[model samples]
Target: MDSNKRRHVGHRRDNTVLPLAAGVAVVAASCLTLFVKALLKRNSKPTQKQGKGREGGSAPKSPGAGAYVRGMREREYVRLIPDVEMLSLQSLLRRIQKARGWQFRDDAARDQAWARVLATAQSAAGGAWPLDFTPNDVTPEQLQALCDAVEAEFLGGLLAEQVRRAGRPRIRVVLGVDPRDPYSWLSGLHEDNTIFVNSNRWREEVSQDNPLVFEGALCRSKLEALAHTLGHELTHAVVLNFFPAMDASSPAYTPDDKHGPVFMWLNRRLFGHVGHASKRLFNT
Candidate 1:
């Protein structure tokens, strides 16, 4: 009886010890798993921070785009014109600027300039120029909205007519605002592509005191200063229309200086005027 009781007590002790040992093993395993997970999280923190720092550090390198945005933001003018005339002038300017690889300073200025130019060109082409030339103090968003309206109401019909008149290459006008420089310029990027205008100069040239001036006083009397600029730029485009390969480096091409009579004749025949001939000539 004593031996059996001792045996029973030993069995009970073995069962309790086994279960305690198993519980201790499980606890140890859980602690090790938590420790490993914490270690991995700690190791990953520095890499993530480094990645975020890199992304943040590399954002200010696009100065050109920044300048463009700034110019757009400060734009304060809008002009509207009929579709037929605007599209025709836009098409021609697009051809000229492309051949020269020129860029502009602001979209608002360009659009306004175009509106002026289109009206003048239409008048010159035996159509009536629109009477509304009042400057508007508008935001970039407003200017864009006006552009959308013009595109829908006037540009489409004008573009279609221009295509019919000039043959199937599509004509597009792209306006840009550049804050880094303050000068308006125009470009035609190939006959098929688009016309680009920079309006930096337009804003400065057209103020309350001086108003805009253009091409001797005679043409100035008939066209707004902005319109005259467009005509001159369009002439550049027209010149390219005939001599598509005439580049800045070409011998036939003179600088902005005034060239001699022969050069003037060539220019007038090809480019339609002799305004900068003297300067281009002396420089050449």
Candidate 2:
């Protein structure tokens, strides 16, 4: 009986050690991460801090979604469904950021700045680049929410309303990190109505260019970037009645047509900005 008790205690100790060891590993990892972060900050340029927290869900009543989700709807808009957690989102972000050297900051200001890098880049391309900071913590669900809000609020009055209502040809935005390719801004899977936005490329472009306009304007800029991208994609998703139909020999319409003159004219009339569709459309 005494021998049996001794063996059981040893087994219990063995089980306890695994959790304890795992806990220790997590703590050590966190400490190391913090240390590295501090070292980087110390060596980096002197940047201002932004301590503001993100506001409520994607509600029209909620304040500026970095001016991305704006324009008065006939009635109040509410999101009935709560955001859902992405599948292994952390692991995915980690891999993308790791490969691209995308640095993150706990300092609200710094994180906000980092997040807005994409917005600044989009703005530098010029479309009244509004001063708004969009956060980096956008979940897949929130992204969808923003899209839905944009569709409802901005595109509702446009000719695209019919396409928006049918909803069969859906549009999707996903976060992908590919270091080897520069097709990072936005790629469309038209067959299935999907758009892939490369997070890695965005980070690389913004970080390298560093078009950060203001000290505390991270979230605003981030949302502006997303809003512009959403608008660009929405244009692709829906065909305006005015859109010239593709034909056998009328001069092959290149993918660049989406950001071409006609599209920009319609874009300005509809949602206010032509976005960074192309260099030619930048100032116009």
In angstroms, how far off is 144's CA in candidate 1? 14
- lDDT tens string, model 2, 139-184? 5665555565555444443323444565555566666643334353
What lDDT would each prediction earn against the true structure?
Answer: 0.37, 0.41
- Best by the TM-score measure: 2
In the range 35-130, model 1's lDDT, one tens digit per residue, is 999999988775634432111122122212321111111111001112232234345545534432332333443445445444433453323432
Return the top candidate by lDDT: 2
TM-score of 1: 0.32
